[model samples]
Target: MNLAVFPRRGYVKDPTPIESCPAFSKALGGKVNIFIKRDDLLPGCAGGNKTRKLDFCMADALAKGADTIITCGAVQSNHCRLTLSWAVKEGLDCHLVLEERVKGSYKPEASGNNFLFKLMGVKSITVVPGGSNMMGEMEALAARLKEAGRTPYIIPGGASNPIGATGYVSCAQETLQQLFDMGLKVDHMVVPSGSAGTHAGIVVGMVGNNANIPVSGINVSRTKADQEALVRKLARETAQRVGMSGEFPDEAVTCFDGYVGPGYSLPTESMVEAVRLLAQTEGILLDPVYSGKAMAGLVDLVRSGYFAEGSNVLFLHTGGSPALYAYLDTFK
Candidate 1:
């Protein structure tokens, strides 16, 4: 996937590290070699997978003459934080529509990304219930902003659209290049599958490049069937958007939804355990939501003999660790 052909804004200055995690692997009983692609270390207010996606999304916004940016996400959404962070740097006003996924979850005084949203000086924020029509809301906001004599661009939740996913396609290329330079070939790679852009991007990129690496996703908020379908559709669309020619296998878009405890944004035992294990062993932190659930899924798969013995697995650590401060009771 040659992302250079696409319009992009600078976000990631260099390739984030693909570091070996011998201690983490040993702690998991050494059934397989483990590594982490530290997308969490990406350059931004705080590093995250969204930084890559925004590189392309903001570029499109700029090309469209956007003066203000509008987007939607959960109250503590890392995407919202990063989007606002970049918008401030880009000199564009940002407006956020936060979904209170859990009823009564959107407290004005809540910490975590919520506080950052205020500190970042977002133009405005409208809190809505979970499952709201995010696109419709963003469109309405755009209309109002237009009436006020401002141009607005809307980035869908998670920035998971075909355009934003280009960042992940670029990442797929980067990952393969790093592996080649190190003389390593990984068997499987896992990432948190939320809005499906990251998962779809990697799937399309790997298939297009014939890297032969399977990219899997762990669902943070949806069922397996739903998440897989979304990822599959977006992967096909992304392949078309990038002008890649190939028949992507239907089985390539895999997702696991077992780790999403009671509901979205709620704490779970597996997540708590996984967060502590990784932090204690490898000195890496995962947020209470996405990456924690993803690590839990990866850990369970490893313990259940899901991977071939001695096979190598890579975890895409899509950073959101700062949200841990908002979920202090989970750790306590």
Candidate 2:
């Protein structure tokens, strides 16, 4: 889809690598050949998938002549950390509205992304209760900034809007090209479904490019039905935003919620196993919240024989290993 027609801040110059994980695959009985798209290595303060979405979102903010950036995410949000990082690089003041999705989860003295927030000098940090209206909170913050003579631009949570989702459309294209270059024929793909930006963009990108890869989302928060619907809606909006025409099939967007455990950011035994398995087997670290849970889901799916024997599956590693420090107790 000609994503070049859209404005981007050019934060990502090269595509992340796609590497085989024989050991990890073997751990799952080697029923499928597994490959990982290392998006966790995307450029940012700590590296993450959000850096891609921010590339487009930040460009939009700058284009509108914004002097300050405002965004929201959960406590220890990789998105917030990356947004603040890029804002610092661009000489823009960044404010964050963090939601304690779990009650009492926001700790002022916490490590991980929270510590990075302070270390990077976020202009302000507002912690909201779980299930708070995040956009409303951001709008209020923007209004206050306006009253203070600051030009504030608000980026939605996870940058899941059409403009931000275009970053993943670009990533989808890059991944397809990489697969082609390597002569790899991936049968299925997996990603984390949270704010739905990453999952939605990949769905739209695959459709737009006529790639036959079916992307499955491992839900970190919502139920399968809700997450699938949210992702499908955003995928359609993103496709339309990128000038893609025609109906996006409802069947295209799929999600599995079996791995969310008790709730968002709550530790699960499967998540711990997945994190340790990858770290030990591949020397790769996955953050506790998103990627770890998604990997847990992937591991379960593989064990359950979700794919045909000898199939090829590609997992999108969205990255957030920095948050691992905060979950030391959980991992322990």
Candidate 3:
């Protein structure tokens, strides 16, 4: 697999750490050994998994001679935050199309990523209703920017396209090398599945490298069937993009939808517990939207004997802890 074919901006210089969490593991009944991939500590204004995707996406945008960027995400989106941060660093203007997934959720006075969006000097922000056609909205914004004599590039929500997904393919290779050096073998891997790029890229990297590690996605929004199919499709596309040829197996993609209690960005009791547990136990913070709920799923699965006794499970901490400020009431 030649990821060199894809242009990357080198946003992430050093590999993120893989650390053991004994206290958190014991809290889950000590049935499985828990380790975390700290993509949460990845580089950006406030680090998150999106930086990995943006490392490639931003490079693609620059390579195409874009002087401006247009992307879409839910209100208080971590993806949007990181996208804007990198654009600022790259000296490019950024525009945002935010979807109010819940009615009246977009507030100018809101904290978290929204506040950061303004502090970082986004060129403009457009809020639309829930379930809006995000790509169309971005294209419309892009048209206006083009008319203004600005070159604009559109990055889909969460940077989940083949280009962005290549970042995780590189991540998979990095991880495999790390595991080999540490003499550790992870039995399974869990990730938050939203736009599918991170999950898909990891799947391709693991399979393409013949590492034989199964990647499980904890859905932040979609159903089990839907998220699994999306990851599988993107995995195939990412593999092909990196010049790998083979059938992308369906069994490689797995997801659990039980943890999404109400819907995307809504608070759940399990999520609250999971967030607080990791913070208190390991001094690791997880965001309310994605990583919190994902940790909740992993906790439940372990408590229910989902994995074999003495198994080692790796959890990908795709960061968004900065969004925690917006959910203060939920945690309270």
Candidate 4:
């Protein structure tokens, strides 16, 4: 709530749209109403949830006089793509450590964000196994850059730290304002949870604003328990960053892991159907890895009557549609 105390580079000058999804809602065949927060349209090379976090993270990098930015993520990481994209905009060299989350998942000639990594002028991209020590690797990269007389900043995967999470805190403010203006009350908010920043930031934001709306995360990587713990920790840290009580209020966070399907970035039957349904019904596309699966979960929940009758549910469309190029075979 006290955003004035912190510094921001200002990536979001305009609030992303909150639109009704009548076709998708009717597809559910329930009394429930559905809406979407189109964060996928946020500014960046391909636009995504990471754009919000970068507003703060990039500002910190600039204040530190960082000449190069180093960060890590999975092979097709939307966060990595957006980070490099913003780095280029700020005239900073960007380097990446891409984790092959699934062994042999890293293909130098791969499309999607991997292609963007090269196109965006990334100074370097190091591929490591899923279990590689990310912070240590980034530190070693920083040391090497220092020896070369370049100042470097290390951004954690997904910018999950307290500072980066503030972007979603601001997002919460924006969403609530929009809902009030539109005379709508959202009973539940759904998001794709991976690396925790977006989910945690929304939880922290909701608590800080006393929005009284529950934030549900469809876990894209970790299990429900693991993801919940991670999100709670980040939410608390984000709250502390803004001079809040730094404690996640009771029932502030919830996550569902059933939609992960085979594994990280692996496609599932449900995800494919959800993607197709949304594309056909709303002319909207959701990336395979994150939002697609989250949509699948939302779809399943609606069909299963998870929400009370006549409830209003909002899905946060954290974008990664550009990566759809890499998974061309999945759709066909």
Candidate 2 has a TM-score of: 0.99
Where does model 4 exceed 4 Å of error? Answer: none
Per-residue C-alpha lDDT of model 1 across residues 172-210, encoded as one tens digit per residue: 989999999999889999999999999999988888898
lDDT of each: 0.92, 0.93, 0.93, 0.92
- For 120-161, candidate 2 gives per-residue lDDT tens digits of 999999999998999999999999999999999999999999
The 10 consecutive residues of candidate 3 with the worst lDDT sum are 241-250
Per-residue C-alpha lDDT of model 4 across residues 1-332, encoded as one tens digit per residue: 78867888888889999989999999889578999999999999989999999999999999998989999999998999999999999999999998888998899999999999998888999998888999998999999999999999999999999999999998989999999999999999999999999998988888888888988899998898899999988887788887776466746789999999889999999999999999999999899999999999999999999999899999999999988899999999
Give candidate 2's error at residue 252 in angstroms: 0.1
Candidate 4: clashing pairs of residues: none
Show pairs that collide, candidate 2. none
Candidate 1 or 2, higher lDDT?
A: 2
lDDT of 4: 0.92
Error of 4 at 107 (Å): 1.2
Per-prediction TM-score? 0.98, 0.99, 0.99, 0.98
How many clashing residue pairs are found in candidate 4?
0
Better of 3 and 4 by lDDT: 3
- Give the range where candidate 1 is weakest over 10 consecutive residues by summed lDDT: 243-252
